[model samples]
Every structure is written in structure tokens, then in C-alpha cells.
Target: MSSAVVGLLIQELPKGGMMMTRTLILGIAATIVAAPSGAFADTPAGNQQAQNTSDAREIVCRRMPPPAGTRIGPRNICRTQAEWDLLQQQNREEVERQQDASHYSRGN
Candidate 1:
């Protein structure tokens, strides 16, 4: 029954559509095949602290708005969680430094 429906759908699609459908199916199959190995990876009960540290080093991603300019899409930035924290701190310090420089220049 399901095979008949799939056959009908495939017959209706254009030539490129079959390739796209196959690619999608293969991607899903790969994900399902790979998921369980990660779930069952050897993690020692006593290594909770190590796990937490690794979590902090895990890759995090953000989509930042394009810089003030002509037409362009948002940029994707990826960094470790710790790196992101350091970046935020550095930016904050830079802003403060600029503010102090401006204040001093104003003779206040």
C-alpha cells in the first residue's frame, strides 16, 4: 500500500525531484544510523566534572545581523561557550575604554 503511494508520487515528480527525495531519505537514514552510537558512548560515572567542563567548551552558534551596509544576509558566528563569554567581556571593556577616552577628551 505505502509502496504504491510512493511509486505514484515518484511518477508525478520531475526528474530532479527524485534525486532530491533520495538525498533527503539518505540524510535521514544516516542520522538514524548514527544517533545510537553517540547515546551509548562510554561516559564514566566519576567523570561528571569533566563532562561539565566539556559542555562549557562545546560549540555554540549565533546569527548576527549584517553590519550597517548594503544588501547582505545575516552572518552566522560559531564559537565555544567559553569563547563567547570572553568575547562579550572584551567588547564590554572596549566600550568602556572608548567612553573614558571620550570623557577625557571633553575636558570633564
Candidate 2:
């Protein structure tokens, strides 16, 4: 049923209903109200992990100068922690590769 009807029923439950019935209706109503919008799988552990991972997906952000001719002010750049770490690793590897190439070319 609709949320409005469930809400009205909950409001009216305390007036004259038995305590057990009221609790049952309240529990059902709460389940309906708190249900997640999307379909859920039966994997409880996986669901909790996924929920925690999504919740932890905050980004590391910085204000950097805009690219040439784009703007005069700084722009915000953001990346997830994992992405930032991977980017740093790749940059280090590239720098090392360039250094190795330079050393070889210099006959060292």
C-alpha cells in the first residue's frame, strides 16, 4: 500500500488497538518505510561490504590552477584514495623509466 495510508494507520494504532497488534503493524510499517530503493541480493556479508565501500568512497581533492586559456581562477580536482595512489605509483614508474633511459644514453 501507499506510505500515506501506512502513516495514518501508525498514527491511529495507539488509540485503541492491542499492544501486540500495534507492535506488529508498527514493525511491518517500519520495514516498508526503511526498505532500500533498489533490489537487494541475498548476500548479507557482500551487501554490508558493498555498503561500507560505497560509504568510504570519499575523494582527495585539491584546488589547482586552471589549464591555459581555460580560466584565471583555480579549479577543483578530485580523486578517490585508491585512484590517487595508483596515479602516484604510475608517475613514479614513469620517472624511473625516464631516469633509466637517460642513464643508458649517457653511457653510465
Candidate 3:
């Protein structure tokens, strides 16, 4: 409620009714504070779109081994599922290339 409306309500209260005025103001304030929370409760389209986007970009976290010869603990790595898949593919390709190069070097 606007301050003007609240002021009018205060003026209209019966003389010496401090308790009633306090209760009315508290009720109005509570309504104002709680009203917005329910405003989005029934918005299905917006909520569904947000849910879908969150599902698609959901994060995956892993504990990666520390670098060779280091005394540090394993570190945490975070990425989306798609990014993890791409990284695994690249690592496999690099291993294959190294194997091929080593084979050629041995003339086998």
C-alpha cells in the first residue's frame, strides 16, 4: 500500500486505537513482502524454459590427478558434459598420434 493510503488509514482509525493501527500496518507490510513470491509460481512457460536450459548446460565435476612428480593433491575440474566429451576425444587422438610416431621411429 502507498504511504498516502496508509496515512489515510491511520487518520481514519478511532481515537486511541494504537493496537489496531499497528496491526493494520503490519498486515499491509506482510502482504506487500509476500505477494511477489507467488507471482512467478504459476508461470509455466518461463519456468519450463529455465529448467530445460539448466538441464542442457548442467555442470559435471571431476577430480583430476596432479601433474607428474608433484606432491600436491589432485585438483577439481568442472565442465559441462559436452566439454568433457570433447576433451576425452582429443586426448585419445593425441595418444594415437604418439603411438603412430613411435611405431614409425622404430621402423616396424
Candidate 4:
């Protein structure tokens, strides 16, 4: 190939990388959406270290699981285990994963 073509290829490097990243991301997303989050679905520990995470997942039994992906402001409220139980067994109880910055976004 000519030098010009080689330079063009180098210029396109990031673009190709972005495309591959996007594809990998989309594939993982699809897998997450299609498969059950059974790995995270273990029963809530009565007093485990991950109480918060357990509280969130336990809501599945009485309340509802958090929504898929990130839930922003004005989301649902799930208080009791009974309510969690009423939640769909699938993934209805997935609370939005809050970053440090977004902690208060849930109308806490």
C-alpha cells in the first residue's frame, strides 16, 4: 500500500476502535437484557454486609425490583419485603444504581 493509504489507516484507528467498543458494549447489553440476573438474585441475608444491596434485592419478594439499567429521578418506592415479594420475580426490583453524585436523584 502507498504511504497515503497507510496514513489513512492510522487516522482511522480510533474510529475502528470506537466501533469495536460499541459492538462489544451492545453485545454485553444484549446479554444482560436477555439473561436473568440470577447471579445477583440470591436471597437477602438477614444481616449481611451488603444490607443495602440485600434490601434492594429483597424488595423483589414484597415490593418490586429496580428497573433495568439506570433509573433516574422520580422512580418507584419499595419499602417492605411483602411489597418486594409482590414484585415480579424477574428484574422488576432493580433500583437505579446510584453513583456518589447521583445519590440524591432518587428523591431520597
Which runs of model 1 end up more than 4 angstroms from their true locations? 1-52, 106-108
Tens digit of per-residue lDDT, candidate 2, span 1-108: 477876677677656656777678778877876686445635688788887677557688978887789757898889886677778899999999998888765454
lDDT measured at residue 87 in model 2 versus the true structure, 0 to 100: 86
Q: Model 3, 45: alpha-carbon shift in Å? A: 23
Worst 10 residues of 1 by lDDT: 1-10
Q: For every model shown, what is its TM-score relative to the native structure?
A: 0.48, 0.40, 0.43, 0.21
Off by more than 4 A, model 3: 1-56, 106-108
lDDT of 1 by residue, 10-69 (tens): 577778678898666556666777888898887787797788789889999999998788
For lDDT, candidate 1 versus 3, the one ahead is: 3
Sort the predicted structures by TM-score, highest score first. Answer: 1, 3, 2, 4
RMSD of each: 10.9, 10.8, 11.4, 20.1
Structure candidate 1, residue pairs in collision: none
lDDT measured at residue 52 in model 1 versus the true structure, 0 to 100: 76
Top candidate when judged by TM-score against the true structure: 1
Best by lDDT, which number? 3
Error of 4 at 1 (Å): 42
Assess each prediction's global lDDT (C-alpha) against the native.
0.80, 0.75, 0.83, 0.55
Model 4 C-alpha lDDT per residue in residues 42-64, reported as the tens digit of each score: 75565565676556656432234
Looking at candidate 3, the ten consecutive residues that score lowest on lDDT are 99-108
State in Å the error of residue 45, model 4: 28
